[model samples]
Target chain A: MSEAIKDLLKKNHMSVTDSRLQILDMFYHAPGALAHADIEKKASDKIDRVTIYRTLQTFEEKGIIHTIPTADNSVKYALCKDQCAEGHHHDNHVHFVCDKCSKTICLDDVHVPEVKLPKGFQPHQSNMVVNGFCSDCRS
Target chain B: MSEAIKDLLKKNHMSVTDSRLQILDMFYHAPGALAHADIEKKASDKIDRVTIYRTLQTFEEKGIIHTIPTADNSVKYALCKDQCAEGHHHDNHVHFVCDKCSKTICLDDVHVPEVKLPKGFQPHQSNMVVNGFCSDCRS
Candidate 1:
């Protein structure tokens, strides 16, 4: 896993650092999207908040991760697929937020359906978020 | 307009105050959703940031306005329709974020289409946001 992380950072032209490696590892193991607080808690005071924030920003800029917006204004970050690259993202899938467990999962297989806008409206991209009970919580 | 604002506040069981009235007025006249910075700027230093924050919270809790989540994690607020009441929001319409002008408009008539989740997922509510050029910017 650490070897893969090193290669990813090298491919993105970012230096291999402990903070970046730890953060990326957490995303790899996360069941769903992770918020800033989650990363902070998982670091167990080893990494400062500023470092985590900066690492997340750098990762996002390099397209290593994507952000998921929530209704309550708390943004969550998740690992991006191999399609994503620097300054370009192809994450067009729908995001699902489990109401029971409050976990946000990327439904990569389910694409966002196109909506018919009023005349004179030109669409570029669309994002859809569905609140529901995930498979784990359903049972 | 002031009388209408007062009545709306009264209906929500909130006392009419300068800060609340001013913030509510901003939402009424806004062309699109207003963010925290927008509200603060429109207040012209008459209202403090804390007051503006509290007023927005009160209005949201009362269902006077609904929040639209943006990709940048900055939540925008817009006035709710008459159908919305305290603790209930019927703003299921699609939100349009204009990539050209950076305006987030509520397409009241464009409802969010139902999405088919995978098996074992039970949906409760869905929110859709489309990014594009609005009618004014299309030309």
Candidate 2:
């Protein structure tokens, strides 16, 4: 895991700093996406809140992570698939937020369908967020 | 426009207050979804910023309007189609945001596709946001 993390930073030309590695580690083990608060908790005082936010922004801009919107309008970050590049992100999968657990997971298997827009609306990218109960939360 | 605005407020059980009326009027004439800043500017200092935010929240709760997430992570609100009720919003249509103009328009003709999630993940509601250049901006 550590070696892979180092390689990711190298690939993105980002330094293998402690904060970056720690945050990346969190994503590596995370079952789904994570919000800023979630990362802060996982960090456990190791990193400040502002630094975490900046790290998240940097990761997002580099396509290392993508943001998912919650029902309450909060943003969450999920690791991108291998296909994501610096300027482009192929995170077309469904972002499933567990209603019970409030955990957001990226369903990589389910790709967002290609929708035909009316004339004159050229589509660059699309996102789909599904709210539901996850496996653990299911009764 | 005044009568239509009054009827909308009445239908939603919202009091016909000046701020509510002004905000509703803005939506009625807006070409696309209006961001908080956009609405505030149009309010022309007649409405306080806090009051505008509350009014927006109320309108969203009543399903009078639905929020759209932009690529830049800003939230914009657009008038819900007539199908939206107090507690339910039939905003199943695709939300197309023009990258050039930064304007978001609800494409009522294009409904969000039904996606099949992996087992153990039950879906309740979903939102699709498409980023692109609108017709006017394409030229």
Candidate 3:
């Protein structure tokens, strides 16, 4: 785990710091997307709120992770695929929020479909969030 | 404008209040959606942050307005159509975020297309936000 985290940081041109390692490790093990409150609750006492916030921001800026917007005003974060890089993100996939478990699972295989926009509206990117019961919850 | 606000509030079964009137008035005149910060900046000094927050919550619950999630974690609110009712929202249209003007416009005519999900994932509601340059921006 530590080696993988170190390699990811190196690839993103970020320094291998304790805070980054710890946060990255959390993302690696998270079954679904994580909210800021979730990280604050699960993070070690040594790491403060501001540090966690900044680390998440840096990770996002580096394209190490992508954000999933929720209706309840809490933005969730999940690890990005290898296609993502600094200042660029290719995570054009659907995000599933389980209504029963409240787990946000990235359906990487399901790509967001294109919408027919009105004339003069040029689309750069699109995001789709589906609320549903996950397979795990159903089982 | 005042009459429309009052009629909308009465239809939603919410009593007309000064703060509610002011906030709803903002939504009515907004070119696109309005965020909490935008409300705070435009609201009168008599209205406090807490009042604004509570008013938004009530309005959402009463189905007077619907939330549009943004990638920046700031949830924007817009007025709902007549189809919406208490605890039920029929605002299934796509939301467009203008990259240049930073406005979140509700494309009322463009409906969200259904995506084929994996088995066991029962979809309840879906939200699609497309980021691009609005017609005004392009023009």
**Model 3: per-residue Cα lDDT over A1-139, one tens digit each:** 4997899889878889988998889999999999888888888757888988899999999988989877666779999876486878889999999988999999998999999999989999999999978988875
Please, what is the whole-model Cα lDDT of each candidate in the order they appear? 0.87, 0.85, 0.88
Q: Model 1, residue A16: displacement in angstroms?
A: 2.0
Residue range A1-139, candidate 2, lDDT tens digits: 5998989889889888999999999999998888898889889547999999999999988999988755557878889886477867877787888888888888889998999988878888888888878988988
lDDT of 1 at A81: 70
Model 1: lDDT of residue B136: 91
Candidate 1: residue pairs that collide: none
Candidate 2 residues lying further than 4 Å off, grouped into runs, are: none
- Best candidate, TM-score: 2
User: Over the stretch B27-132, how does candidate 1's per-residue lDDT look in tens digits?
Assistant: 8889999999998888854788898888888888888888997766777888887537778787899999998899999989989998788888889888988988
- Reproduced native contacts, each prediction: 0.86, 0.74, 0.84
lDDT of 3 by residue, B22-130 (tens): 9999998999999899999998757898988999999989888988977666878999965477888888999999999999999999999999998889898999999
Ranking by lDDT: 3, 1, 2
Clashing pairs in 2: none
Best by lDDT: 3
RMSD of 1: 2.0
lDDT, candidate 3, residue A58? 93
Would you list the rank order by DockQ, best first?
Answer: 3, 1, 2
Fnat, model 3, is 0.84
